[model samples]
Target chain A: MARRGSYAKGVAKREEILDAALEVIAREGFRKTSVREIATAANLSQTGLLHHFASKNELFTEILRRRDEVDAVNASTDPEARFIDTFPMIIRHNSKVPGLVQLYVSLATEAPDPEHPAHKFFTERFEGFREELVAEIQEGQRSGEFNTRLNPELAANSLLALADGLQTQWLLTPTLDMAAHIEAAIESWRSDPKP
Target chain B: MARRGSYAKGVAKREEILDAALEVIAREGFRKTSVREIATAANLSQTGLLHHFASKNELFTEILRRRDEVDAVNASTDPEARFIDTFPMIIRHNSKVPGLVQLYVSLATEAPDPEHPAHKFFTERFEGFREELVAEIQEGQRSGEFNTRLNPELAANSLLALADGLQTQWLLTPTLDMAAHIEAAIESWRSDPKP
Candidate 1:
């Protein structure tokens, strides 16, 4: 019973540290933020933080993993929900968490190099996300929810790009009202004929 | 006569160094690629490279500036061309230069911070680009080339986002057909009713 209690405490501490790290990274960006600063923010000694996360890279990777997990959960809530239908909601949720979005954009841009630590993660993320989106679009077309004239693969890529691009613009210009723009794009996708 | 020849040689050397720096940055990212590597790749001594570029940041800024200049020239060829009409061609051109595209994406992601060296450049670039796009859209509407019902600002922002997002995805997956996807999005914008 004592072991279980301690394990639960450890999990709580880890979550606290991740929260602090997210704030620091969001405020200071990944390149400028340091592990020591994250440690201090979490009210833990650097050694204590190290105990939970072996290195800054490990901590950063964990944060990304957790974000992906959350996104996966949100995306899967309705097994019957088409992925395209949920994108605007996801973008709306993302607007509420600017720091996570910043981290994603910054790291994703940096991770294109084959040697970057997050390279494989981002590559696989895009490939998997693209595939899932393509399948969803195909399903929508079959069900007549989406225009059959549009190429599913191309439409899927455009939707993903629009979401990412809007997040970036919103980050740069916070007053941009990202959700509305995304909704507009989605609306167009649903109604427009092939060009 | 000797001084004139030396000045011409210097100009040639500067272009050569920029080319090498672009190659190095494209191969490794901005963070990992060093001034020393750039100097070596340019076949110049570190001192020689410094004589042209005071630091890596300066060199990077210059590279970005040059790319922008090229983009501006390409985007402005037909004075009467609607800005949105040229996007597909620009994207087609971008596909031929993955290195520059990668550099732009990586740096633009990092430049969101007010303190980042490229922060002003990116902010101004987006603002200026967005304004130009808005103007172009307005012109298109007046000329009946674009849907008059669309908000020029929203439509312009969406188009820019689509371009940036497509570039990021293209960098991640070189096989993606970026120009075609962008064209489709633009087509939708021109025909779809507001949702």
Candidate 2:
């Protein structure tokens, strides 16, 4: 009974740390946010924080996981809407969280190395995201909303790549309207209006 | 004079080092290639190579510059082609050198930091590239080769973003047909043929 109580406390503490980390990262850019700062914000020593996560990489990965959960919850609240419909909103939300976006771009570029600690996390994330996008695109095609000529897999990949690419650009040029560009690109893929 | 002769020799030596670095990076990929290995391939000590470049960032930046020169020479061999028309070919050539592509992606992501040595280089490169694309796109619009409704600036940005995004995906999944996707994307922008 004591062990179970301790386990629940540990889980609660972990959530507290993640929430603190997210607040710090969102307030300060990723490059400026340090683990020590996050730990301090969470009312833990650096070592105590490390005790919860295996390493900095694992901690950041979990932060991203937590972020995904938050985004999914926000996106899914509209039960009638599909993933594609909410993509632009997600991007807009991302624009408001540049720090997290920076973390994502940096880690994604690094995670291509098979031995990187976040490698498995990113690999599975990309695969799952692509699968979800493909399924959504195929549905759009069946409904004659998207051009049937478009390959669902390729479209999914392109959309994901475009979003990633736009984020990179947005980082450099903050005023770039990423969501608008995404909307325009999606419009290009829509089936041509009847003559 | 002797001084002039030595200056000429120094310039030649710099070219030789860049060529060697390019060869090494093309074969080994950006992550696996090291400065020492590049120095060895150029038949120079690391210090000797550093004499020609202010730092590793400058050296890699020069390598990219050299690559752009080489690509431009290839891309412009046929004077009739505009930049937009030749873009898919450039993407195809990029696919052949995954190492350089990886280097480009890594450096681009890093260069967003204002303090990064390559920041100015990328800023200018993006601006120049965008201007060239916009000019070519405007020319196509005038020729009725592209839809007049599409904003040239947005289209240029979209194309650049798509290419950058596709490169990111290609790094993760090697079998992706980036050029084919690019071709299809360009096709989508073409003006509808009169019935």
> Number of the top candidate by DockQ?
2
The runs of at least 3 residues in candidate 1 whose Cα sits more than 4 Å from the true structure, single-residue gaps closed, are: A1-16, A23-31, A43-55, A71-82, A192-195, B1-20, B23-31, B43-55, B72-82, B192-195
lDDT of 2 by residue, A1-195 (tens): 467589888888888899888888888878736678889878899999999998887888888888888888887687777778889999989999999888888777777677777688877877898898898888888999988988888778888888888888888888889999888878877888997
In terms of lDDT, the best-performing candidate is: 2
Model 2, B1-195: lDDT tens per residue? 367588888889888999998898899888846678889989999998999988888888888888888898887688777777788999999999999998888877877798877788777887898999888888889999999988888888888888988888788777989998788778878998898
Candidate 1, clashing residue pairs? none
Window of ten residues with lowest summed lDDT in model 2 chain B: B28-37
Best by TM-score: 2
lDDT for each residue of candidate 1 in A20-123, tens digit (9 for 90 to 100) = 77667656555546678778888988888989876666677677877777676876688777666777777787877787888788777766667776778878
TM-score of chain A of each: 0.78, 0.94
Candidate 2 ranges beyond 4 A from true positions = A32-34, B32-34
Residue B126 shift from truth in candidate 1, angstroms: 1.7
Chain A vs. native, model 1, TM-score: 0.78
lDDT (tens digit, per residue) of candidate 1 on B1-195: 467588888777777778677767656545545678778888887887889876666677677876776676876677777667777888898888787787787767767677666777877888988999898878778877778778888888888888899888887788989899878867765644545
